[model samples]
Target: MVQAQVTRREFLKASALVAAQVTCGAWLTGCANALAASAPPPAASDAPAPIATPTLSRELPFSGWREVKYYDQLASAVVQCAQCPRRCVIAPNARGFCQTRENRDGKLYSVVYGRPCITKTTPIEKAAIYHMLPGTQSYSLGTAGCNLACLYCQNYTIARAKPEEVESYTMTPDDVVAAALKAKTKSITFSYSEASVAFEWMMDIAKVARAKGLKVILKTGGYINEAPLKELCGALDAINVDMKGFSQTFYDQVCQGELKYVLETIKTIRRENKAWLEVANLVVPGYNDDPKMIGDFCAWFKENLGDDVPVFFTRYEPAYRLRMPPTPVETMERTYKIARDAGLKYAYVGNLPGHTGANTYCPKCGKLLIERVGFDIKQNQIAKGKCKFCGETINGKWA
Candidate 1:
């Protein structure tokens, strides 16, 4: 496993100075004449700003959480959560399947509201969104619990745990926006465990971020109801939906979710046409990595999502309950070929660094557009949302 990287707090001090571009004045605390928020990024030779020690400390653990919307009250003090496809019928003082929302006396409350287990800045590429704002940073945060039960969950330590089961940091919507602004990230992302389980928190932060002229992104399993997803489409700037598998058997036996709901959610997002959309499927060996299944996935994508939306067949790591070895590089290459054979315009193989599969090529001229090493961009040849060489309009949010 890759060693853990430093936290946002335990970061370099000079990094902020380089970010501020204040060569004339510098100090241990911060730099003078900090670059304007609207200032253009520096050249490739210039080092990006190191993470600032976020002075805004985390608040206390979650308690006395607030009530959430999109729930229906039933007889005998029961409530049904309508946020995700689960539509879990919660008993009085009981929690839902995800353990993030609780039903209290016929009212539903999001127990994980304003409480995030992890909050950090990441490259937008890490979200598997290569076409939008390449090389820019995104502020990301996520709480515990997830709607779907993936056996090979990479973040099961938090994802499989209940809200109270894990230590969390309280962060209101204002606090999230403030931290994103402070970090100077291009966008704010709701990621990690599962954003859908923390519906109220994700919506609150996305709305606030949108109002502040900061773009909002969501990395989700696409296991949500239409009403809530439409609301999210209106607020979010970009969304990367995790399409777990192609077959219903795979969805039922492996992910413990329905395949139809995920497909509906993806279609709903595309129908709304409000947010930039991308799809990612974790290729787990002996689960859903069959070549026929991949071909079916590509066919479904072509029919439903067209060729513009980018799709990634990501390398699955050994984690959580699954003891399978890492997905082989040769498997990633086959998936890429499957996508190409399906006439996919922008399909990629993710998670393996320094591979040609990680790069983006123009659909028209077939010239290299973006070269990513892990989550960092090494080269970007798209300008004004078009290929620099052939001037073909790339389908994504370029601004």
Candidate 2:
């Protein structure tokens, strides 16, 4: 691993950086180094996780900025973005809260459309999606800027930075598809920062990914408006929505977001029945870890998402503004029990490798279905979407 890491700063010597070895922003060499160098050290928490780098490059054209498709122009050169539930009303020359969308004159343009700071190839399991193409590779990418203000964001190095603050690449949708193909990945994933913040790039890549018979997956906070989400779902094959917490108070205090909007986002995606959906709750200690709150969360999840949709209660590590200790394994176990007790068919735990909670068990015959070691699959007992032991029908898009 002594080889030079690819970042927008030193890697852009010519053009066309490889998709597998590029990291984002300044801190990422692009974001990891550049942003981390100038960014103030977190006075409250440990440093955020490093953005992994991708590799290779070819010169591609940068489009400056792409005009967004969802927005409403108002009088006096103001516009309201319809992309996320925030619906930021931006003035002329102003930017949205995500800092990736700007109102230039009267039109809203996506500033991070083709200028991702990172595009590393990883396993689909890292996307927190276990039901689809287990063990298959996923080509992932992310840009700077995030919509919500999560106090414990793990990738805050890129999430808190602006596109201008980071070194970026001119990766078009076709370029992304070509890279994914070169990497021999089964899906193209949008992750790292709030993927929806770079909605245009994701959508364009999804279209090309689909035409080329590659799956499209998303790891999102699910804080999006109804209309734009439906269109996004049309191309997405799988989605892992981060259900921050179950209560409104948690959202208000920790994330500075509305619980209602995220709830609607989940419902809209499920109701649309387009993408295979999974939910993850990062178990932040003492914040969203109350037993009663977890029970309520599971009950609501069972009622709304039913039995098939996989749910995860993952561990939270200290990062960004929040300096809480890593979530206890006991707490993770507690949430998993609560989810299963509420009659959920599929419940898993993450951020802890070698834990049995990471394995997939059959809801019907109580058989071990998929054994996973971190993001790697050890043994897959479920075959052809059915449990090998009991022939029970499993709910997932099997490879």
lDDT of 1 by residue, 1-399 (tens): 899888765543333334323211112222321434357766778734342322222333336477888999889998899989888999987898998888777889888887776777788888888878888988888888899999888889889988767656556788777767766787998888888777777888888888888889999999999888999999889999999988899888878999999999899999999999999999988888999999988998999989889999999998877888999889889999999989999998998988888888999999999888888788889899999998999998888
Q: 169 in model 2: Cα distance from truth in Å?
A: 1.1
Highest lDDT, which number? Answer: 2
Mind giving the per-residue lDDT tens digits that candidate 2 earns over 200-277? 888888998899999999999998877778988887999889989988889998898998888888988899999999
- Ten-residue segment with the worst summed lDDT in candidate 1? 23-32
Error of 2 at 309 (Å): 0.6
Which candidate has the top score in TM-score? 2
User: What RMSD, rounded to one decimal, does every model reach?
Assistant: 8.3, 9.9
